[model samples]
Target: MQQNAPFELLSQLRSEAIALAAQGLTYSTQSAGTKNIAYVVNGVNFYCEATDVKEVSVCENLMIVPQTKAWMRGLVNSKGVLYSVTDLSLFAGYGRAIQAKKGHLLLLAEEAVQSSILVNRVIGFRYFNESDEMSSLDDKQEALDGLSAFVDKGYRADGQDWYRLNVSKLLASEQFREVQ
Candidate 1:
C-alpha cells in the first residue's frame, strides 16, 4: 500500500488539472480586430465589439413607460438585472423595428450608462480582422444621420458593408442620457 501512495497522488493531481482546464473558458487574443458579434436591426446589418456586449437573449416581460420617446421600449428584468430597452433602428433613424413573435435583445456592458438594445436577429460570431480595409462613414459619404456619430467605422466582407456599432459613444450621447 505504501508503494502505491506516490502513484495515487500523481494520478489524482493529473485528473484535477484536466478537469480545471476543461472548466476554464479561454479567450482568443489574436491581432484580428477583436471578436465581434454580428446582428441586424431594421434590415441594417451591424457588428458590435464582443467585449462591449454582456449578454444576448429573447426579451420577456418588458414593462412599457408612458410619455417617453418611441424609441424607448421601457424596462425589463433579465436575470435579476433591470435593463432599459431601446429600439436601435428607430433611434438610428432607420425606421421602427417591428418586434417578431420572439424579440431579441443585446445587453450592453455594465458601464455608467447601460441598457439593452433590441435587435432583429443575431448573425452569429465573426472575427473582424485587423488587416481588413476600413473607412469612416464620413469619408465614404454613407452617413446614417443621427447615428453617424455612434459608428466607429465600416468595413466590407463577404460582399457586404458591415458597420462597427460603438455602444460607448451611443450611451454617452445626450440623446441617450435624456430618458426622462
Candidate 2:
C-alpha cells in the first residue's frame, strides 16, 4: 500500500499511532457543519480543520529569522518582508507532515503577521457531515485553552475517519508563542 520506505517506518508509525490514540486528539468546529483537512506524510495520515490552514506554498530560502528564544524555524521571505516561520508539526508532536522541500509552506494569519506551519504533503481539503457529533476535550481543554473544540468523526485519506486537529490550541502552544 506504500512505496520506497524502510519496513521500520511503518512499524514505528504503528506504535506512534497507538500512542497518539491513547492520548487526546484535538479539533475545532466550523459553519455549514464541521470541516477538516487531511495531511499525509510518509504514508501516515494527519487531520486538521480547514480553517486552521492559512497560505500554502513551496519552501524557499528564509532570510534573517532571529535564532533566539523564539521557536523560529527560519526567516522566510514572504512577498518582501522577512516572515518568521513556525514549525507546527514539531509542536503537534509528530514526524514532519511535509518535509522542508522545494515546495511546502502553510502560512496562517495569526492576528497580524501570519504564522507559518510546515506540513508534509497537504493532501487536500475536506468537510464533515452535520450528523457528526462533537466530543469536548474536557481535561484536555485546559491545556488547549479557549480556542480548541472536540470532534468525534473526521475524514481520513484512506476513507477511514479520525479526530480533527485543534489549530487554536496549536497556535497558542509554547511552540507558537516562541515565534518572534
Best by TM-score: 1
Clashes of each: 0, 8
Report model 1's TM-score to 2 decimal places.
Answer: 0.76
**Model 1, which residues run further than 4 Å from truth?**
1-33, 139-143
TM-score of each: 0.76, 0.54
Cα-lDDT of candidate 2: 0.55
Candidates' lDDT values, in order?
0.77, 0.55
Q: Pick the candidate with the highest lDDT.
A: 1
TM-score, candidate number 2: 0.54
Stretches of candidate 2 exceeding 4 Å from the true structure: 1-35, 41-44, 64-71, 95-98, 130-161
Q: List, residue by residue over 143-171, the lDDT tens digit for candidate 1.
A: 45567778878777777777888988888
